[model samples]
Target: MRLSKLFKNAPTVNITGLCLDSRKVKKGDMYFCLPGMTFDGHDFIPQAIEKGAIAIVHSKDIIDKLPGVIYIQVEDVTACMNQCARLFYSKPSDKMTMYGITGTNGKSSCANIIKYIRDLKEPCGYIGTIAIEYGKVRIAPDLTTPDTLFLQRKLSDMVRAGMKSCALEVSSHGLSQHRVDGIRFDVAIFTNLTYDHLDFHGTIENYFEAKSILFKELVKEDGVSILNIDDDRYEDLKECSKARVVSYGIDQNCDYRAINIHENAKSTSFDLVYKGQKYPVKTSLVARYNVYNLLACIAALHETGMSLPVILQSCTKIPQIDGRMEQIECGQPFHVVVDFAHTPDGMEQMLRYGRQVAADKGRVITVFGSAGKRDIAKRKVFGELADKYADLIILTEDDPRDENPKDIANQIKEGIQNKPNLFVEDRYEAIRQAIDNASKGDVVLILGKGDEPFMYHESGRVPWTGDNICALECLKASGYGENNNS
Candidate 1:
């Protein structure tokens, strides 16, 4: 593409490539100088040019101008880069129906569910925490929300692969960084804003305001915003949105609401009440929290012009959302679940479900730990929630990245000190202990680090089997499974 396609009134130059990181700048590539939280991209301009970046796009003023290189200064570097990427990629998101889902939790499950429903009608692409999937392409995500250039490239790939729609999980960090700005989303879904990522936003209000950017700034004025009216931030997000608002929840006068919910060991059934008509839904999804995810998915599909009956029909065959209440069966007498419930709101709901699933004479055993350099406030709260609903609590390692693992566990132990709990530093051993201690009919809940393949540590990217896999291995080693050799 011509450089002029990116910057108006600039010289027409053939751009070979685009780059955000100067280290990755190739010869003849156009490099974008971004002002970031930690490092200033402007400082790397000479290095980018040194590495043969012929064109420089920057938001700040250039102190020293180099001859023979194109310098286009914009008001916002990230926004300008986003626009350029959109143009360079031929605006792939516009070619397809784009749905963006945001929240502290459930973004992955919601996005995945929407993709599954859309796939029943037509091929749909998905980009989120677990993985990026479209037309047999599966990539382990480096970030929950990839960079603008990478995101546009994937959407372009999806469009080329004959996908008519895409379900994308929009993260608060992505919103604040202007990563998803140029895409014209057809529907924006807000699951719920809870107390997560406060370390990044500093305050709950700031975190909320960051989440609000998607509805208020990104979604088209003619597009629709789907919100959970049962959430505390519903009023704020609804009021902030310029688009038409559609609400969904279990307890609210919503455009889509679930009623008469029923759950068995195998599945959950709920009636989706919209307007005056009701659609029955039954899926393997368990827990009240997932009911909210379903409502949001149904509402998004409706706004996307999918027939309500077809969507409800699709809901009945909902695929198990991996790591979000994913069950691990190995012929154990008790039940075991692996989940990505790392926040207070998420853990509370998962534990409540755990309490319900435990047999009358069984126990609800939970094993989880907080991460390093995150919202420390939630650590003790996690302990308290486990104390309330779990019969035994086992604290273990979870990305204690530069911080001491024992210290992280102690912070969580502060609240449940008087309760039945064990501090186990090694994550694998903790899982083994939890499984080994489980009696007949007991329920084991493993929280945090869901299906993540790597554990974040100070050493960086340590290989680790995922929570679900580890739990499965431990269950097999416990000598109860029919397939076990032990």
Candidate 2:
């Protein structure tokens, strides 16, 4: 494509591709010099030019301009990149039905559920923490919400592959950064927000504002905004959104309410009340929080023209989401659960469900740790929640990047008033100890780093088997097999 086609007012040049990282630059690629929190892309302009970049898009003036390469100056490189990416990709999002789900927790599960419902009628794609999947192609995501250029490119790919709908997990960071600026959403779902990502947003109010941008700006005027009415921020979100609002929750006043909720170790059944009608719904997903997720999914699907009867039927087949209260059973007498519950509220909810699974006959044992360089205040809170719920607690390393692992563990230990707790810096060893200590009818909950494939440290991101894999290995080592339970 010609550069003139992307930037009508700018100079004409043959544009082969678009890139943000200088290291990934190829011949004829237009390198975008975006300013980031840590490093400025403008600092790598010389390297990008060295790698045969034919054009440069930057916000600042270049003192030494390359003679042959085209230079396009913009007020904001991030905004410019978004526009250029949308134009270059032929605005693929406009060609398909798009759903954007935003919140601290349940975003991935809600996005996946929406994708699952949509795929029942037509081909659909998913972009979230687990993977970017469409048709037979699946790739691990580098970020929860990718940059605009990569996002638009992926959507374009999905459109070309005959996908009729796409589900996206929108993070607050992505919204504040304007990564989803140009894309129009057909349905925007707001899962409940909680105390997470404070290190970046600095305050809870700022976090809510960032999340509000999805409904305020991204969703089309005629689109639908599905909100959790039970959340405190629902009124604010509904007020800010220009689109039509549909509320869902356990609250009776909500547009869609879940009543007579029956949750057990394996599944939950509820009567979904919407518009003065009731539809019985059941799901294999565990936890009361997942009930909210199901409500959001039903509301979003209903807005997309799916009937209550059809949606209720589809609810019976909702697949178990990876890393969200996922179970690992190797014919062991005890049960093991792996979850990505790093926040204090998330941990409390997960442990509550773990207790239900343990049921009075068994003990609930929890193994979890906080990440470094994140909201440090949550460490002690996590400890308090663990102490309140779990019979035994194991503090271990969870991506202590550039911070001392022992110090992070110690911070978490400060809030435990009276509990049987042990500090284990090695994550794998912690899982081993937790499993080995568990007897028959015990429930072991491994929190943080769900389906994540790597562990971060000062050295770098090291290859590490996820919690599920480690728990399964320990179960095997403890002499449990498929035939052993019988």
Worst 10 residues of 1 by lDDT: 477-486
Model 2 TM-score relative to the real fold: 0.98
Q: TM-score per candidate, in order?
A: 0.97, 0.98
Query: What global local distance difference test value does model 1 have?
Result: 0.90
Best model per lDDT? 2
lDDT of each residue in 1-486, candidate 2, tens digit only? 789898877677789899999999999999999999899999999999999899999989898996998998889898888888989899999988999999888999999988898898889999999999999999999899998989999999999999999999999999999999978899999999999999999999999999999988854656999999999999999999989999999965789999999998788999988889888888888789999998999999888888778888888888877888888889887889999998887899999988887956799999999998999999999989998999999999999999998899899999898989999999999999999999888899999999899999999999889998899999899888887862
Q: Which stretches of candidate 2 lie over 4 Å from their true place?
A: none
True-structure lDDT of candidate 2: 0.91
